[model samples]
Target chain A: MALLTVQDLTMHYRTKLGGVHAVDGVSFAMAEGEAIGLVGESGCGKTSVAMALLRLLPDNAQILGGEILFEGRDLVKLSEHEMRKVRWRSISMVFQAAMNSLNPVYRVGQQIIEAIQQHLSVSEREARSRVAEHYNLVGLDPKLMDRYPHEYSGGMKQRAVIAMALACSPKLIIADEPTTALDVIVQDRILRRINEVRAEFNMAMMYISHDIAVIAEVAERIGVMYAGWIVEMADTVSVFKHPAHPYTIALMSAFPSIKGDKRVLAQLPGEPPNLLAPPSGCRFHPRCPHATAECVDEAPRLEEIDKGHFVSCWHPQRRSQ
Target chain B: MLRFVGGRLVQIAITFFLFLTVVFFLFQAMPGDYTKQFIMNPRIPPAAREALKVRLGLTDSVWGQYVNYVRNVFTGNLGLSFEHYPREVWDVIKERLPRTAILFLVASVMAFVWGFPLGRYIAWKRGQTLDYTITVAGVLFYTIFTPLLALMLLFVFANQLGWFRTGGFLTPRLWLTPPSSPQSIFIWLAATLAGLGTWAVLARFATRRIGHPRPRRLAQRGLVVVGVGLAGLGWWASGLGPFAWDIVWHMFLPVLAVTLIAFGGDMLLMRDSMLEVIREDYITTAKAKGLPDKVVRDRHAARTALLPLVTSFTLSIGFVVSGGIVTETMFSWKGMGLTYLNALLIQDYPMAMGCLIFTGILVLVAHLVADLLYAVLDPRIVY
Candidate 1:
């Protein structure tokens, strides 16, 4: 059994523009102690997948159809009261903007203590000691635990949020585009810290970001998302080395380094199709160069082209292997 | 910090000069006769009244009279009072000013002392039943008309219950026209400067200093606080009753009423200001530091959020003065507001104009004080 399985999960958002098919029939499963990357365009439903998995989707959003089985428990059926117990305990997430995520009027220690004490039946002093211990683990000075959030640098704030997520020692952590908002230097440091946490605790994580280069560094398995569907999923090394699906080939060709010596940077023409009313046959057909009559009429289902490697394109080998 | 204050002072002087010029011509727009109140109702011979007008420069062009009035004001003579039996405009103001100043200032302080902490509690527990209860109760208490609230408190605690004095500055016998001796002078001075309301509220809402915060650098902080308090008290003492105790005794009600009113406003403003500040991202950072919510709120948010409240203090001067319109009348206290109301009815033109000019100056000064305070609270905020 997988550590986490999200099968046929469909999440639609009712927006002012109309019903947005934010996460349409997305399916994936994670093994214990595995790290996966969900790479996509800005609105290609990566965040929707993360938010839906946590049941933290906003008021107007609805899980239209789905089954999210985590350790044999169906998370979708749990009430908000029951789910609150699961959040920050069974599953935790860290967002891109760490500073704004925390409450300003509270001390960093108190917020962590709140998470720890809220989840466990521990006394205040014990919660505080654990808070001090976590601060030390993040390489922050435990003595400055009484300071305000503003006193810390941007990197420190992100680390604090990471520590907060780890308060319950959650099995699976979801980090959504965590480095997208940080400076280049700070981004490297945050990624290093996240990797260390996983190594130390053996926690499975879902890393979401637009930068394929950053995702390549940490993600063991990579999933390229187009519109609301996963166009391709494979071992990171294999996907980086051998591009298969046309969208994946286009994505690799566009990033000069991805195709090794042969691939010079090549830009894809036009934009990702609007998920609200995407193309009938294939979401990426408009952007796919080798799109055929069959591609224009039939959407490709994800098929295992090789062992533990997946592709969802009619002409999977469009480019020279 | 010092530079911001200096700039504000210069701004205030420019504003004061412009307003002073405007007030000089206010009488020119009015249709009242400054010389008529002193004249009898019986028909004076037309010649005598005309002669009286001429002697008083009533026949002069409005500009000429205005120029002369401004000149006299500069020379320390604010002309004479038509409302007071026989006194100058300057004297009448000097006599009534202290009571108003003492009452207003003390009330403002008392209100902040009560409201700030209460507002914080309500904010910290926002959306809870206790928070809602306090918030609703505060709004309701503040909504009750000042005079009526005073009367109701008076009725329950004094008339019906005889727990406290109903209204008035002192024992009715101690009302002062002028000091008869040295002891009466002390009474006048004390009563005119001290807050009767603060005395009462302090007793009811006596709070020990928060954090059991032992004054660190005790000698230095203690002296500064005492010195500042004394300076403020001295300024207030300069304008009140003739004798010390009588002035202090009479100041009781006006001061108390002001304090009560301020209690609600400052606290409510604080509650709002704190709620807004704590919602910012920095609060979460503060929380992640492992500081308790209490320390985070008080140290991080409270001091920065206090800037708006300091700016708000400028507005309280107007409320205290306007509020004194009722406080003075209820207590039978003779202050600028009560005296102005009387002058309006009797059509005492000189007294009325004097009151208007006086209030306009006080309002301007209060506004200047508020602007100066901003730099002190948050030096980074430049406006």
Candidate 2:
């Protein structure tokens, strides 16, 4: 059985303008020790889907419909009291922008210790030891925990945040653009450390990022999202080799390759559709090169086009071709 | 840290010197000198008036008087008061300082105690009816003139209800002399011990019940009940004489007025700060860590929000030295405000200069203390 499965998860944000369908009919499953990368543009609801899995959406957001099945129980049905027990224990998250993710007033160690003690009935001393251990696991000096977030470098802060997420030995970890704010060198190091920790713990992970290259480095399978819908999902190698969805193909072509023939970077023709009043048909129809009359009128559902590959498109790219 | 403090001290010294110079020069430029009161008296002949001006050094050159003033101030001689001749200006201030300190300390403590929780509650329930009601009330209290509030309190609690005395630090009827007899001394000592004992017992009880669930709250309420009962018993036992109770009773209106004004500002400040802090990413991080709502709000949000409040708290302490002038006047409270006003009215240059200089020093010291506290509160600040 999968460690976590989110089926038909529909989330909307209530704003003055209208309800924004941030994550519409989003479905995915993660088996034990599996790592799935969720790649999308800025407002494609990538972060929203991650937040929905943990039931951590803000006050303005409403889960219009969904089933977040974790450990054989529908998390959507769990009370806030029960859900809190699952958070940071069975499931933890590494938030984006480590600078603001950690409380400025508190020492880094105290924050990690707080997370440990909140879910576990452990003494302060025990929690401190656990925090030190997690710090070591994340390639950080145990003494760095004594320092405040501002005192540390950006890379160190992100490492500390990752250490905090690993403190409870959670079964599943959601990393939401964990290294987006760091320099290129620090980003590579942090991503490598994350991969190492994941391998060591054998924990399931859902890595969310806008950079396909970063996702390619860590995720075994990638789910491409576009305007609140996952346009495609397949094994990393297969998806890279034969991207079925036109949106995925355009996104792939956008990434400049070093070794390939010198070609101009392909740019998607239009901006992401407004989620408040998303298009009725395939959400990507306006920008899809293979858009047809049927695609303009009917929204396509995710269907297996090949073994272990799902493409939500009326006209999918063929592996034989 | 040492260098920071040293720098601040030098700045303070310069400020003090400038303050003294401005005050001295401003008073010198006034229409009349301190000897005007004597000159206006018809009983004093022209020859007597001239001698008085010479004696008071009013006939000296401005430059000579400035040198003398600076010299006297440096030597710890604040000069004699013009109104209360022969009495030192420092002596008059020393006599009144304790009353002002007590009034301000009581009001400030009460304001913080009442304001912080109310502010936190309002922030937690931001869009609720309770938040709106308290916010409106806070604005009303903050905007109302201090003298008006004082008079309203005086009328209702003192004049109309007769619950407290109208004015003065003590009741005129029962001005008991200090205990000279052994029996009276014994009674005073016993009352003092009783008050101390009651407080100790309450503290011990509270400390013991710190972690207990509902009983801790119950114990706190019980402690207040017991304390009030003991205080009432002590008042009756003292034959209802003019004791500490009389001072507290007379202090009621003035303290209430000051507290109302202070409470409003403090509450609104805290509320606004907490509202901003709650939106910070760290607060969301705390919640995502699966901590309870109370922990997230108090530990993560409120702790950070308290930075601005800490700054305001120190600034308010400086204002305490100035005292609530209008409120003091309305209630006829003999504090620094009244002393300063009296000095100004009589053109007592020495006394007025002393008050202004003291206030300036206080404000400068408060800022230095606030900077030091900022470093302590937020570890990121090195100096």
Candidate 3:
């Protein structure tokens, strides 16, 4: 069994206006020690899917039907108390906006130490030592642990958050938009650091990013999401080389340089549909150039297209007799 | 600025005129004039009462009486007090005003001296046991304990302790011998104010990190420690000594009663403000560096949280200056509350109205001071 398996995971947010199908029937799995990417636009349900696996959705959010299995155990049925024990030790999350995720009134060292102490039986000094060790591991000065958050720059704050996430040495670290706020150089440095840490610790990671190039730079496998559903999934190099879904094709066409081709970029037509009232049938049919009459009436099911590659479309290709 | 002041000056003029008209009608609406209470005596005839009413202008129109009252008020002539017969409203107010001002002035000074730092401490240390304990105690005080506590203080010091005068500001001896000059009166004021000033100076300098004479600095720090230690001693001081103790003894209950009310609110507000500031993103950056809670709270959170409190402090002064009628009555200190209440009870309407105007002006001046402080404290808050 894979380290984590998500099957038929559907989540919606019940807002005043209407039900927003944020995470609509998304499903994926991650093998142990393997990294994966969940890539989509700003309002896509990528974040919702991540939060649902952790069962940390807000009050208005509902997990209508889903099964999340971690280490062959169903995480969907775990009690809050049981989940708390597993959070830092088994599955930890480094939230977006590192500045807001970390509490400001405490020293960075204390915050990391708090996560460690909460998860393990350790003395204050032991926790401090561990925090100092992580500081070195993340390439931050251990002595700077006593400094407050305001003294650090934006990139440093993100690094501190990453260090705090890795302090407990969890099996999986779900980094949601970890480097989106950083400058290009800083983002590259952070990605390189994360890649280095993954190799050293041999830890599995789920990297979410809006940029496909950034995701390809760090993530081993990629899943292209469109309108709360995964449209393509394959090995990173193959997915970059031969895109299947129209949305993924548009993304690849728009940024051919990420595939080592410096061609003129052709941007996609129109914006993503508002999730509150998504179109019936295939949600992306409105924007799909290959849409026929069948695509308008019947939604597409994800199917294997080639070895270790999945594509979701009603009229996928000439070979799909 | 001149135009704004000009407008306010016009407002003050119109308000004063309208106030006189209202006071004139409201007082005449009483069952009868001061002489009517005497009419209930069996010997007084109907013709004699009517004669008294005509002489007193009881039959004049309300507007006519208002004009006469306004004329008298402007000419430094406050009408005679009904209760004291010939004593003008100014004389009665002058006699009582000092007692009220001194008590509240002392109370305000005491509250700020201790309360500011204490409130700031609790705010900076929010969600800790000390903060929680103070908050719980404050909620208990404002919601449940204050009135009962006020009564208990009145009883314990009044009935059981024969140490100090139960109520009133000065000894009968001092009241009988009026000071001949403003210098003597000012001296009395200085003597009354000596203790708090000395304590404040000691606190301010001792808390400073700057240069001082080495020995003086050490001595000052020692004094800070000892003075803080001597809270019980100072508290006990209120119950000992002859005439001096009587002032402290009587004043303590009222001051204590008012302090409990004001401090509880100030502490609660400060704590909430500090907590809100701590949640800001900048605070998180500060924390990531491993700074101590005190540095985070005092240097970061407190500096921001104190912006609103400058305004709150002025409003609190207004509340204190108004004087708690019950606290003053319990202390029997003859402050404004007691003076105002005594006048209202006797239907000495003009004297009562004058007291109201005096308090109204004081509260307005305090609010004006708050507006000035707002511009100084928060640059974003433009006048």
Candidate 4:
């Protein structure tokens, strides 16, 4: 069985403007120890998928329809108490903006200890020792754990946050743009450390980021999201070499590859369609360069286009190398 | 931290000096002096009136008086009161300080204790019926006229139900039959409070270092119980329980009126602050950690939310010590506000200036304490 499966997940945020369809029919499956990346532009529901899996959404967010199956159990049916037990112990998250993820007032070590003591029957000493171990694993000094978030540099804070995420030894870690707030050097170091940690533990990771380059470094498989829909999903090599959905194709072209011929990075025109009133059919129809009459009228289902590859487009591009 | 405090103290001293100078000139600019009454009385001849002005130091150059005022203030001599002849200005102010301090300080603390949790709860339940109801009610009480609220509470609780005294800080009958006067009782009260505050602080500091959770918790509870028992025994042994109860009984109506007027503002502030804090990314991180909602709200969200409330509470205590004018007048509470008003009404410059100076010192100290507390409460704030 897969380690986690999210099927037909639909989540909407009840705003004053209207019901914001943040995550519409989003589906994906991750095998044990597989690292999958959810890559999208800002406001494209990448973070929402991460939030939905853990049921850690805001007050206004309504999970209308979904089955978050983790470890062969349907998580959507679990009570909040049961879900809480599942969270951090089974599936923890490294939230975006590590700068603000740790509470400023608390000692960083105490916060990690709090999480440890909550789910496990550990003595304070034991938790502290575990926190120290995680700190070392994340390439931070064990002594720095006693310091407040403000006392640490931005890179150190992110490293501390990563340590916190790893403290519980969770089976799955949903890292939502974990390196978005750090400088390039720190981001690269943190990503390399995350990959190393994942390999050591053989833990599944769901990496969420708008930057494909960042995702490419860590995720084994890639899911390209747009307007609350996953436009394409494939193994990292397949998605990079033969991206089927036009949106994914455009996203691939938008980046500069050092190995490729010198070519101008293509800018995808227009903003993402507002989720509150997204286009009727394929949410990406308005922005798709190859949007057709059928694509304009009918929403496409995520279909198996190849062995273990999925694309949700009426006219899936079959680009030959 | 010591350097920060030292810098703050120096700043306060300068501000206080400027404040005293302003007070002196403002009082000096008044149309007439306390000797004006004697000047109109023909029975008191012009020579007697002139002697009175000279004795009161009223017959000096404005500059000379200013210099004399500054010098006297520095030496802790507030001079003699004009209206209450032969009484030192400091003595008069000292007599009223405890009354205002006890009543308003107790009321303000009660307001905060009651308001903070309510505000946190309402904010945590934002947009719900309970939140709306509390916000509406809190805003109503907060904006109500102080005198009107005081009078209404007095009329209902004091007059109609007879649950408490209608006005005054102490029962006149209780003091009449006493070897222990109100002054002695106030002194005892002050000492007892100071002792308890120190004990609590020390206990907290000592208990914080305990390693084992169970023993640490037991120690905390044991400390509290012992402290309470000691305070009770002390009160009973002193034979002042009845007098203290009488004072407390008399304090009820005014404290309630003031608390009702003030707690709502605190509640509203706490609610707003909590709202802002709950939106912070750390709160979401706490939730994502699988901690229960209550723990996330209080431990993570409310801790940061309490930052603004701390500054407001400390600063307000400085101003609140001045006592409420309308509340004091309506309740007939002989507090600092009333005393200051009476002195100004009679144009008693020394007494008024003394009151203003005391208030200025309190406000300056409160601001310094607020800054210091911010550094303590928020690790991000380095002194």
Q: How many residue pairs clash per model?
A: 54, 0, 21, 0
Estimate the TM-score of every prediction. Answer: 0.64, 0.93, 0.57, 0.94
| Best prediction by DockQ | 4
Shift in Å, residue A34, candidate 3: 1.1
Better of 2 and 4 by lDDT: 4
Query: Which lDDT values do the candidates have, in the order given?
Result: 0.74, 0.85, 0.73, 0.89
Model 4 ranges with Cα > 4 A deviation: B37-51, B193-240
lDDT of 4 by residue, A173-283 (tens): 999999988889889999999999998998999999999999998899999999999989999999988999999888888888889578888989988998889998998
The 10-residue segment with the lowest total lDDT in model 3 chain A: A312-321
Q: Evaluated with TM-score, which candidate comes out highest?
A: 4
Pick by lDDT: 3 or 4, better one: 4
Q: Is candidate 2 or candidate 4 better by TM-score?
A: 4
List residue ranges in candidate 1 displaced over 4 A. A121-129, A258-264, A318-321, B1-18, B25-81, B84-383
Model 3 agreement with the true structure over B163-207: per-residue lDDT tens digits: 545566656664454434332443354454665467858676665
Which tens-of-lDDT digit does each residue in A1-321 have in candidate 3?
589999988888999899998887788889888999989898788888877766667657888887998988787888766776677678777777886766544566777776787678899999998888888887899998887766788888888888987887888888899988989999889889988998899889999988888899888899999989998898898787777788888887776554453667888888998899988888899898988888888878888888888888876543210
Q: State which docking tier applies to candidate 2.
A: medium
| Best-performing candidate as measured by lDDT | 4
Q: Arrange candidates by DockQ, highest first: which order?
A: 4, 2, 1, 3
State how far residue B227 of model 4 sits from its true place (Å): 6.1
